[model samples]
Target: MSTSVADYLLDRLRAWRVDQVFGYPGDGINGIIGAFGRADNDPKFIQSRHEEMSAFEAVGYAKFSGNLGVCLATSGPGAIHLLNGLYDAKLDHVPILAIVGQTDRSAMGGSYQQEVDLHSLFKDVASDYVHTVTVPEQLPNVLDRAIRTALSRKAPTALIIPNDVQELKYSPPGHEFKMVPSSLDLTWPQVIPDDTAVRRAAEVLNAGEKVAILVGQGARSASVEVQQVAERLGAGVAKALLGKDVLSDEIPYVTGSIGLLGTRPTYEMMRDCDTLLTVGSSFPYSQFLPALDQARAVQIDNDASLIGMRYPYEVNVVGDAAPTLQALLPLLDERADKSWQADIESKVARWWETMDSEAHVDADPINPMRLFSEASPRLPDDAIVIADSGSAADWYARLLRFRGHMRGSLSGTLASMGPGVPYAIGAKFAASDRPVIVFEGDGAMQMNGLAELITIARYWQEWTDPRLVIAVLHNNDLNQVTWELRAMGGSPTFIESQALPNVDYAGFARSLGLEALTVIVPDELGLAWDKALSADRPTVLDVHCDPNVPPIPPHATFEQASNAAQALLRGDAEAWGVVKQGVKTKVREIWPGSSS
Candidate 1:
């Protein structure tokens, strides 16, 4: 007898370290589910109320483990529903493998129920695909290759395992299964910029009195390199929020995140700095960048296109942050500029101590900056933060400083909504015992199907509570970024449309059997939130807030923009005119202050 294709595929996934599979069941592939039952496997099968939630759960697992997240569905509509959630993983570069059940070979012409062309449906979304027919030999190769491709590119892949194929029986000694290692030995590229370019960057650093280093997400993997580079020049450093753990914040050069939620002194120093060295970030915020009239930027990154895309660069070098910095560090000389670094550190500490200026506000609702600051301390030191997109993410970046060991990852440029729910979902499944939090906007919470949260509830039951997620809901009835857009004079309707309405998220969450509460006051936040955080199950703290609030900009940039604000110190209408004209007159590049 020949073994079934689905069984072979399952064996391969087991070898790939898939501890669980999330999916919605249907016809045409009940054979695969049956096979899962027969094996009495350790990888638990999670049933999602909707197929969309299955995909969300898979993404959650993938993002947390940095491994292949698996989701399954029967052919036709089941396979199709996987698109939106799969695309979430794709855009974010999360490794996911969607095993979609297809119809029997005999039903090729759509004779069977729920039959559809799997290839065409999943096109444009799945980075790779596996077509499994036979169980003995061919299927395993497809499984290995598909799994490898997903992990290699840090992207998702799809596999179409037919129903009839899984039911087919094979004889003894037909084939043996193979386990693929999840990691590869990757190295810096052989090509390095000539010593002359390195020397030029070194010279610019040596000559500049008030130079600063701006770290991006790419530096996360190269923390040592960033530290060495910052040390060689005694440079002050500020990070894009996504690069939270690039280096320990204890370093004297560290000044915190740059942008709106960034430090005033860091922004001012960037403007005053003779040289700005940007590494590995395509930070979208243009307004927070240093002035072109003053600072000359030197940039290095693995991606050549990002160089000089946002800001004008006097020097551009293409290489990984660490390798390039390693070459440049040897040519650098230390500066006697401890004063600037020391001054910035003092200001950063001041902001850290009283980020809300509570001595002034007395009460502020849902202070994202302050929440992250206070809550981050309670989290496990080795905990990994998997974040969603939107204002929730922006706040985490602005406030949360990672201990050297904690790693944080989020949807980068794709910046898709609803990822927070799925990400929190994934991280919980990946590390059941770790302190996992999902601070997402209300809009994102709904997009994350209720079933995913229920699944988290189920896991927490087994893993001993809070094994799923500490979900912090920002309920402002508006997309937080809409406030920023309006601040720039965007259409009111567009801004209004983003605010979610009419959903009783707390009620819905409580209905799903997760611990849930809604907070109306600031003092109630910490205690009510801890109820969920301290619970033995998943919890959501739905907190209402004022949507009209905008992010606090970096103090130093505020001073310059204040100086720029001097261009129209006249009055209200006058101030609007100055901001409008200034924004329009400048080019649309990330660092819009560039004259070029």
Candidate 2:
């Protein structure tokens, strides 16, 4: 059997069981894109509005589906656009394969138009595996290596095929490309630590009176095992942002999140713990973690190099989260005392009260926190939510309570904006039967490449249940950066730089042939959510939010207070209002029995 290199590549992808490919067309990659069209039903080629969104949608697909994600792009700028999302997948440890186009082999070293060294450009991002196929014969081995390396290493891999080479005749020596078995699905092997390491970890955990567990995306598949360990040790669980859905917020022992966007329960749990058990989280914030001198620690991770990279640990169990915990569970003595856990639960209760007060505040304009809390219940139990960076993240991280089968994520390490809408679109493709929801700030909604909502509209009818919802928090301001300036003792000057022109997102969605709604009142948000979810196709809900409300830190430092005071002195009305409101709320909480 004989085939062109481009068709052979698609055949190998089919052999690897890759069902979807996201990308944009360009002159350099016209041959490959044409091959995609001719490859029968091997893979669904999703046309994104921009190459950046194509890459981001691929990242989202890998994140939600737990499978290999593939995206394509033409030479030069088209290939360059994939770096951001590829880096996101690399940093987050997701498997993705980028099939990039290249200038013709004949133009090598001549610097033809649109000729850029993609190999050199992708060197750092796709460090694990980066290669190009200069000839037809090299395609088979390189394709196998790229896809296998991406799946096994859980990172992004790149294959740059020249334009002329993509159309070259290809016939392998022994095996025919089309006859290769597509039934064998490759999966990463489950690694378990040795008995000695497991015993040492259990011993360290057993010695401490107060144990706290910090989990990340690495521990996602081990929820049951993590909960069992937490329960047996009477430990409090604090999840990293990437691991938000690992344990539901309603779980009495599970603190919502860790870091600045973390809950008070998580902060207190880490601050007072005698022992810390880290499971698959390389949380970057050292300040948010337990001090090295304060707590003895045990760390479990599949990557041995990342075990003690974040913090010092007495025992390092280098293995998969679930398997390691499964081996260590029987070696531990169940904790008999419950005082520490009870104290943490009490603090969580009070934190909920504070959050509720913030979420249901009666203001003329809707509070963003209130929007998240009120609208959360209306979301489907199994909904996959993606929150964009900025103030919207502050609200989503602090408010949305994951229960039942619900899950959510954001750009954890990249922390980039503009991926929310693309992420939701990618997740919809991964979980076509479930409702896919996104919470993005107006600033992000207007950012470059978010027009891929039109891509969703294009393929809306292909889905089993395309219940995709885009909920935009319309404050017309870069609320997070403004709050940061105030918190850092700087005057909120040059307000023009932070302000956004009002966008009628509902109208925008409607114009794109999707159901849409706009609401200014807080009470009306629930109905908007209901309408969005009930609609058969995609929907967008734009809620007018109060710009005056601040996303106060979970545990404010003295310097933060001083900065707020300085901002107030600088005639910042929002800052002054925040301080006054915060003080009054604290007073009421501290003195509930007082007559005054």
TM-score of 1: 0.77
Please give each candidate's TM-score. 0.77, 0.95
Query: How many clashing pairs per prediction, in order?
Result: 16, 0
Q: 122-219 in candidate 2: lDDT tens per residue?
A: 99999999999886767777788888889888899999998998888976644556343222345557896999999999889999999999999999
Window of ten residues with lowest summed lDDT in model 1: 584-593
Among these predictions, the greatest TM-score belongs to: 2
Off by over 4 Å in 2: 173-187, 448-450, 573-596
**Candidate 1: which stretches are off by over 4 Å?**
109-117, 128-136, 169-210, 250-252, 258-270, 274-328, 358-376, 464-471, 474-476, 481-485, 493-513, 529-531, 552-596
